[model samples]
Target: MKSTLAILAMAISVPSMAIAQTPPPYQPGMGDLMVTIVQPRHLKLGLAGQARNWDYADYAQHELEESLEAVEKHIPKWRNLDIAALMAATVKQPLEAIEKAVKAKNAAAFDASFKQLTDACNACHQSSNLPAIVIKVPDASAFPNQEFRVTRP
Candidate 1:
């Protein structure tokens, strides 16, 4: 009877022990999400457009949009400013233009739209009082292992 009680107590305590050992969920800061998620997608989009890789450009653009959406959802406000509103005011239109350009596979349009997007990013930074965070057209590929230029089939 004592052994049965001891076994029952151990079973009940096992779950509590596991719960205590588990770490808290990781909640990344806004800057961390931007650096880890948004920046790479933006770079890839620029590189794809520059290389005239429309398919990759489209994919990159979509990824960027999703990253931005995720950021807005995760951190709706930063420094007391509404991030969603800021994004809508700044990057939203440019992203739409970029999507249209990508769909059309127009290199010229893509270039112009990409410039607009880059400028919008800079503008957002400035408005957010992050004047030092200047974004521009990517002149060099950040991913050395990945080829930006599409090989002709």
Candidate 2:
């Protein structure tokens, strides 16, 4: 009777012990998801906006925002960087202006806002000690067969 009880207890306790163990949280030092994902998306969105490809710009904006959110969700704090807030301070104004222009369908306003967004991208890169990664308004179409001209709907 005691042997049977001991076996049963061992079985229950063994599974419980296995279940209790968990992998440690990921803690990469730098050049993590923020750089690998978030930063590039930000630069691309700015370039798309500058080209006045509203449809593509909107998509890029959504992608950039989602990437930023994902970075924050996966790794909320990195190297003591208030990553979300830092990103906000750099991009918020330009993003808001772009949203307003996009709503109004004002080409002039969109152009100006796009420039601001590009500048912000550079600013952030410089602030992050990544000045080598310069961003600018695209001069020539890089994506072939894709329209960047202002278009309806």
Candidate 3:
């Protein structure tokens, strides 16, 4: 009877030990957020602008901005540099320009502003010692399923 009780206690304790040793929730690093959140938004924004889809361009631009904000929020510091400060210094003005272009539905301005934004992105990466992570104006649609072109009803 004592042996059976000891065995049962050990079984219960084993599960408790296993639970205690469980790993913490996964926390995405800066690179993961950039690739997963920022890159796709940037690509979609470029495609929308290229296709002259002003409404979708506006939406994509906002998404890109939010992704950048989230990146700054999630990883406020990277390589000992303030991510928010870096973003403010590099991409803020270009994003504003892009916003203005999107609102105005001016394709030419959108193109120019998007280029400026892409340049700013590259500059930020270069300054952050990530020059190999080059960003550019999307020359082709990476998302084949999404229709970037404006459709008139």
Candidate 4:
């Protein structure tokens, strides 16, 4: 009877033990989430900035920041680029500059900062050895189905 009780106890604990030892969080690979989220948001922000749609630009910038952060947290390493530092050095400044220009309504500064940001994106791609993933100031809206126009409301 004691041996049967011990086996039952072991069986009951096994599932709990497994549950307690959870697996590490699932992290997508580099270039994976960037392509999925970062790149698109970056493009949208640029397009919105160009369109002078400052309201949507704010949201897009936040999303761009989040997307890059997600990449750094989920997939810390890329082919040769240290994503965290690269993001700080290459992407963050122009995003801030753009934010400032958008806030101040400085057309010239906005244009220059936007160009710098696009260049930085391309620079990052080149430095990461993925030059094929070229980024630019979007010329046209790919998301026409969604309104990008700035509304005074």
Candidate 5:
């Protein structure tokens, strides 16, 4: 009878120990999410456009747009400013223009739209009092592990 009680206590305590060992859910800050998701996608999109890799450009552009949307969704307000409204006012048209360029597979238009998009991002930063956070055309791929070139059949 004592052995049965000991075994039951052990079983209950084991579950409690396991639960205590589990880590808490990860909740990334706005800056963390932006750096991890949006910034890389933006750079890749520019590189893909520069390479004239239209297929990859289209995919990268979509990923960038999605990242921005996710950012706004997760952080609707940052430092008491309305992020969603800011994004809509500054980025919506430029993103649409970029999407148009991507669909048409026009590298020149993509370049122009991408410039507008970059400017919009900077404009948002400025409005948010983060003038030092400037975004620009990527001169080089920060990602050396991934290929941005078009794969010709």
Candidate 6:
């Protein structure tokens, strides 16, 4: 009888212990996503363009664009600011211009468009009361593990 009671108590407590041990799902903030995904891709794209690695630049540009889209989708409204509208007004044209420059493989055009994109990013930050978050062209490669130079087949 005592063994039966012990078994019942253990079975009842097991589920509670499991529940207590389980962690909550991770929820990343807007800044977290930007720093982790968008910023790195933007830097890499700039590096690829500066290196005249058109193929890699094309891939990196698309990745950056997709990251922006994901950010807008995930956080349509942040702190009462409409992220989608802000992105459309500020970044859409610059991103399109960058895409055109990438497709044409025009380094000068890419540089101009990239500057526009960076300016738009800063503008958005300023408008959002985050003037301290200023983005610029990377002077050096942050990723030493990956090569920005194009490899000929």
Model 2: per-residue Cα lDDT over 24-89, one tens digit each: 676654467656776666656656666667777777777876776676666666665676776787
Q: Which is superior by TM-score, 3 or 4? A: 3
> By how many angstroms RMSD does model 6 differ from the true structure?
1.8
- Pairs in clash, predicted candidate 3: none
> For model 4, where is the 10-residue window of minimal lDDT?
74-83
TM-score of 5: 0.85
Candidate 5 regions off by >4 Å? 1-23
Model-by-model lDDT, in order?
A: 0.94, 0.71, 0.93, 0.82, 0.92, 0.93
TM for every model, in the order presented, reads 0.87, 0.60, 0.89, 0.78, 0.85, 0.90
TM-score of 1: 0.87
Supply the global lDDT for candidate 6: 0.93
Whichever of 4 and 5 has more lDDT, that candidate is 5
Superposed by TM-score, candidate 3 places the C-alpha of residue 101 at a distance from the truth, in angstroms, of 0.5
Residue pairs of candidate 2 with colliding backbone atoms: none
Candidate 3: segments with Cα more than 4 A from true spot: 1-12
What would the per-residue lDDT of candidate 5 be over residues 61-141, giving only the tens digit for each residue?
889999999999999999989999999989889989988998998888999999999999999998999999999999999
For model 3, residues 105-149, the per-residue Cα lDDT tens digits are: 998999999999999999899989989998989999888898999
- Candidate 2: C-alpha RMSD after superposition: 4.6
* Candidate 1 C-alpha lDDT tens digits along 41-112: 999999999989988888999999999999999999899899999999999999999999999989899999
lDDT of 3: 0.93
**Higher TM-score: candidate 1 or 3?**
3
